[model samples]
Target: MKQLLVPALLALLAGCATTPPTPLAPTGPKIDTTYTAKGQSSRARFLVLHYTVSDNPSSIKILTEQQVSAHYLVTNGPQPVIYRLVDENRAAYHAGVSSWKNYTQLNSSSIGIEIVNPGWTSTPEGGRLFYPFPQEQMDVLLPLLKDIVQRHGIAPENVLGHSDIAPLRKQDPGPLFPWQRLAQEGLVLWPDANRVANVRPIFEATLPDLFWFQRKLATHGFAIQQTGMLDQQTRTVLSAFQMKYRPSDFAGNPDAETAALLEVLTTPANAPLPVVPTPVTTAPVPPLPPATPPVPVVPETAPAPAAPLPVPTPVPPAPMPAPVAVPTPATPPVPAPAVVPATPAAVNTP
Candidate 1:
């Protein structure tokens, strides 16, 4: 019995040793990290700048908790801190219903940076006083902008303000925002001062019409209607441009300086200045000839000659019909009385 037990235990041990442990099932998918495709580009195309019209705590809370969000938020202070709320690869809920040039709905293609600042305050005289951004905040923002621009190869023209994209609705990063600083950093396009000076006089002599203003604004990447009138929408878009380029007077009115800036920005270095339409004046009509006595008209004694009679058209004679022969039946049919049934009924009554 002992030998049997020992042999049984040894057999079980041998069977267990001979059988390989069942391979553990894989818990996750395996991917090879050997190669990467070069034909790829970053999802972010434009860098839109904005201002958070609230304090740092409120801004952070609203951005994180509310539906609206941005990729980065630069807090306001002497030493401002930058917080990246959303990943660069993901779309932020900024730039709602926005457009730049031909692109629309910029939230899908842009990375938004919201700087903490009180947007604006209304003055007693019905004017707005926009808040200025701190230099430290700008300093932090510039490096971030440079990094993103370098990584994504964003164009200088693509660096836009929230107001630039949504001129009809938004006015963030308002007139006080330092656009010249961005220009200096080579993040945005700036019109040449010399060119602006040279072209300003031409516009000063005669300002371009509203149509010209709309065209130049559209050409400069603002989404404006080509209305030939100075409509509110046109004025708003014009004001957006002025807020960026000429902050002193953003009243949306077309001035010589605005015209020069627009022309210089939109026109190529070699392109000729657009011809301004000359105002047309009507010539004064000569005084009507002094009224002269009406000359009595003489009526002809003979009546007008009778109209000539219309000539009658002669009718053509009808052509003779060709004779057609009809075949006769072989046997003649007998004719029946037409009223035979009525006569039979009268005879029955009789």
Candidate 2:
């Protein structure tokens, strides 16, 4: 019995001795210590423009308290004020259920600016009249937009309205909003009147079907459904396009004029046009396109309004201007912020 107990204890001791010990964690040089950036990029790739339908106070509440938010808000009071709500480095919950070209979920890489406006005013005739942005609002907004575009290196084409991204759902910064003003400032592209003049005659003879328009709209970055029929979706896309390009009349009805405008935009800038041997008449730049350009329901109905020349799609940022380090406003930026003048001055980007 003694020998058996001794042998059992010895066997347990041998088993314990044969077990391997737990290994210690290795410690030596730190990884990725000498880091060097391969290339450069901007935190924000797109700048989406919107108009808060709610008035100043309501706009503030909807933007801050509600689920929706914007990086900046421009007020429409006597004194137009630009308020910074969301930081540029972070995402804002402004664009939803949106797509542009191949990009979707724009909130991930876009900076949104909400302009405060009554948006739609009640008409005695039981209709809604979309209001235009004030001169003062555009004044501050221009500089602020310029600053953002320059700092972030946003392309002229990438500067889009809420409608441009979500044509079916949004119409803010509506038909009355002055897009040509941005075009004149080189922040966006405006269709060339001359090109439209040359193309209108051709489209009048052979109007392309709805399918062509849908394809062009998609190519130009409006997330429209291609049903090959003139559906509500197509009209919304037309309205959105006309709101920006032909604000004079946005009936959502596609006409020869709309078709021509679409063609001009899709036409290659380098594409050649017919040239006749005559005195090149300098086209009369129509009185700075009206606040609302008259939309003709049908192009053949009257001396057709020439198609607006094609405006190029958003381009890359390098040639326009590189972005700079913007001062991050902690809250709604109410204080008189330094304006980035629309000039040749270069911005210091980090």
Candidate 3:
């Protein structure tokens, strides 16, 4: 019994000796990392879409080796792959001299996605032909877009094309890009067709002046100057809008339909439709009635006194202009300055 007890005591001591000592409490300054402020939001407020205008290999090399970069890239063809070229936490040199709404220098606050596309080619007839994004590429892109948009809490209006943010200098992700598809996915805002129809007739009677178009475009988030004329910059911006929403005829003419579309988009109460609007089926503006032929003035007889020779048929008074609708409560239409000509209806497109 003594021998067995001695062996057991020795085994117990050995086990205790093998056990590690408890660690000493850390003595550095304590940082309470658990408490986080709820007032903060993501640095990325906008998602700008672009077209690389080059093949995949060229695109990859240029994006990586050059000063310009994008957060993500979607390649073209049947089996497209998505590449993350730039870290989302850092700014990419995609947007240069860009502005949207009140925000300028958008690269600092936007995530850019460069899609592999040729942008547009000029036809022999002096017309531009834009390339269409493939279905396979779109399928891959849709998921990535959804993921980023969800993670960043991006708004529908904030998903914009390259041309949209920099209308004056860029037209990438051109008319062929299926923005209507994005709208159907609830990733982008589309003007409500019904609202456009409701407002169209009013503009059809007499389209709003160029100054009005500038104000409405600014309200809809384009950084447009109110030049009060149909300038090249305004046309380019207007064309960008047309490419997204109305690709049928984007001649950049300030037509009644364009006016209606602008009004609908800028309306605070506008609820964009999730479905794609039928292409090339915008409600046609009714043709204006021909002006009443002016009555031919009979040559006055020399010194006709008492009997005014047979009174010529009296001309009817001109019809009063239709009342313009003020959809924007924030910006009531300013009375045109006297410097602005009384007759600006005859717009000269540049």
What is the C-alpha lDDT profile of model 3 across 104-222, one tens digit per residue? 99999999999999988899999888888889999999999999999999999999998999998999889888999999999999888888887787787777899999998999999
Clashes of 2: 13
Q: Could you tell me how far off, in angstroms, the CA of residue 296 lies in candidate 1 after the best superposition?
A: 63
Give the Å shift of residue 100 in candidate 2.
Answer: 0.7
lDDT of 2 by residue, 1-350 (tens): 99999999999999999999979877987577587687989878889999888789999888999889999999987788888999999999999988888999899989999999878987999867987787888898999989999999998888999889888888878888888989999898677888888877766777878888999898888888789998988988898999899988898887878877887787777886533235678988877755887787775555768999999899677765679999996887578878886888699999
* Every model's TM-score: 0.70, 0.67, 0.69
Candidate 3 segments exceeding 4 Å error: 1-32, 270-350
User: Best candidate per TM-score, number?
Assistant: 1
| lDDT by candidate, in order shown | 0.91, 0.86, 0.90
The residue-level lDDT of candidate 1 at 34 comes to 100
> lDDT tens string, model 1, 1-350?
99789999999999999999999988889988999999999888899999999999999999999999999999999899999999998999999998888899988899999999999999999988889888888889899999999999999888989989999999989999999998999999888898888778789998899999999899988888887999999989989999999999999998899999999989877787765556798999999999999999999699889999999999999999999999997997878867745443345553
Flag the better candidate by TM-score, 1 or 2.
1
Give the lDDT of residue 284 in candidate 2: 85
Q: For candidate 1, report its TM-score.
A: 0.70
For model 3, the run of ten residues with the poorest summed lDDT = 270-279
